[model samples]
Target: MIHSTININNNNGNNDNNNNNNNNEIEEINTLDSLSNALKSHITFQILKDTFNEYSKLIKYGNFVSLKHITTGKYLTTDDKKYLTGSRGQIVFSTDALPEANAIWKINYPFGSQPKANNEIVSYGDTISLQNKLGKMLWAYPNYKSPTSGHVEVSCYSMNQYNNWMIEPNISNISTKKNSNEEKRYLKSEDKIVIWCIELVEH
Candidate 1:
């Protein structure tokens, strides 16, 4: 069974909340109301996942996981904050701040192409969806740049080159690091992970 069902009260699928303008400019940037596996591009970096460098645990569908930005040591987060310009999108930023709610995300199978079993763990080459507490799925604006960072804008948006994420394991702060089988690497809770999204250009 699916671990949990997220109830997004999006005006019964209407953008009526747009009028609320409660400083939640982030949610309005998403026009992808449908959460199906709409990404048509193949994994642009299929050659990279073969690097068995770090032993990471397998993430399963419907798993609530936290993704921390490696360099900044901050959690990938989003909220009611808005960007002053660019895509007019809601802001998606990394923060080393308190209040853990916004930093937590639930991993989901793409809407229509769900797995036969909900407990199926993530493996190499698996494409997944990430949804936040506010019920907004993780999204990115590939064609746009952030007004501040001037990089690809990633927010609780929708389908793009999720390209497929490579899980990089973090083993610090855990009192004990245990691997039952020498041949297997199991990712555990609070494990630090890196998500890489590379854009491919077809020539």
Candidate 2:
């Protein structure tokens, strides 16, 4: 299981116009620790395992079981996985890859700066194999820095249903990694990047 932590703060919108607005309660933000715990509690690792299984199948047999290309509405699985090269190569996946299968959780590196909500950058464009899983898509987004935290979101989709009628039930998992000065630059301070995951569930 994976988990995360977060902090809650009061909304900063206090004005005279809506003085009587009773819905001004502060929003709850998960701390790094809280985010981590939540993901673990939800059995997120199991979800990833399933996604990878499905992804691998497409590569092996050539098919699209979920989302369309948003343009082609057709199945598309590139053969790049077989002959992957240097860094930032074409999209690919391998069972023996890092953040191993059923990887419980993984932290991303080289991720710099945190963007406001709705500003999630593509961390990794990879695939998973989830032959028969309950959940849709489950992903984790590590914090950009320490004390700030990271997040994870999950969603579900169906191939038999209408193309645009997919339902997404997502949960963000945020966790912060603590490090020391002597550790490697990437390992020393876990504040330069954010790690996130996506789990496509079948309903």
Candidate 3:
């Protein structure tokens, strides 16, 4: 089972606002925390093992990995396991638990550019896109059901930034290899770079 640690601060600042406004903000934060906890409780080790086994074969690119939310320590996942028929309204959410089938994402390089292993400068126009097992690409909207939702969704259309994603590996995983045949090859051809073994960590 996946576990998440959340820190909630209830400190009151010396502001001119009335007590009612502070109480309201506190209430909203508590509600959001409750929802996050509920999502975490649903994840179990069996579900994660099963999901990994089922999707292991579909992962082709070395960059393909599970995305962990920076703040929540949760994975991105679909609202349900049901198949979506290329609908733009398909819902995606952050889950405070191990990912299921819908959460697996394949990182794809920009069109016309060859894939590289090094952490080269990838512009927004050349940013990678995330594709799920269902063949839908991840999309984000400026305005959706709510402003706080971040407007993340999956779409069939291959739009610009809506489809583009920036994925950076955990800093601890980035290291240089010395005195190896692969390093010699990389020195000969800078274009041919190899990414060492990496353990995906929360952003």
- Candidate 3: worst-modelled 10 consecutive residues by lDDT: 184-193
Assess candidate 3 and give its lDDT: 0.45
Tens digit of per-residue lDDT, candidate 2, span 41-147: 56566698776654332211111133222333332122222222222212222122222122222211112323233212212122222221222222221221112
TM-score head-to-head 2 vs 3, winner: 3
Residue 66 alpha-carbon offset, candidate 2, angstroms: 1.1
In order of appearance, the predictions have TM-scores of 0.51, 0.15, 0.40
Write model 1 residue lDDT over 1-203, tens digit each, in one string.
22322233333445545775333322222334322222212243333343332223345566666666656666677878777666665678877762455766766676556356666655433556767666777777788888778888766554433523344444444223346753334344445544522111110
**N/CA/C clash count, model 1:** 5
Cα lDDT tens digits for candidate 3, 1-203: 33344444445764456654432232232465665654455556458766665433222333345656654566666644322433445567667675545666656665446757643422222357766656666776544432234343343333434466543333332223456564311111111112311223211
Superposed on all Cα atoms, model 2 deviates from the true structure by an RMSD in Å of 22.0
lDDT of 2 at 65: 30
- As a whole number from 0 to 100, the lDDT of residue 110 in candidate 2 is 18
Q: Stretches of candidate 1 above 4 Å error?
A: 1-57, 158-203
Candidate 1 vs candidate 2, TM-score winner: 1
**Where is model 2 poorest over a 10-residue stretch in terms of lDDT?**
184-193
Q: Which pairs clash in model 3?
A: none
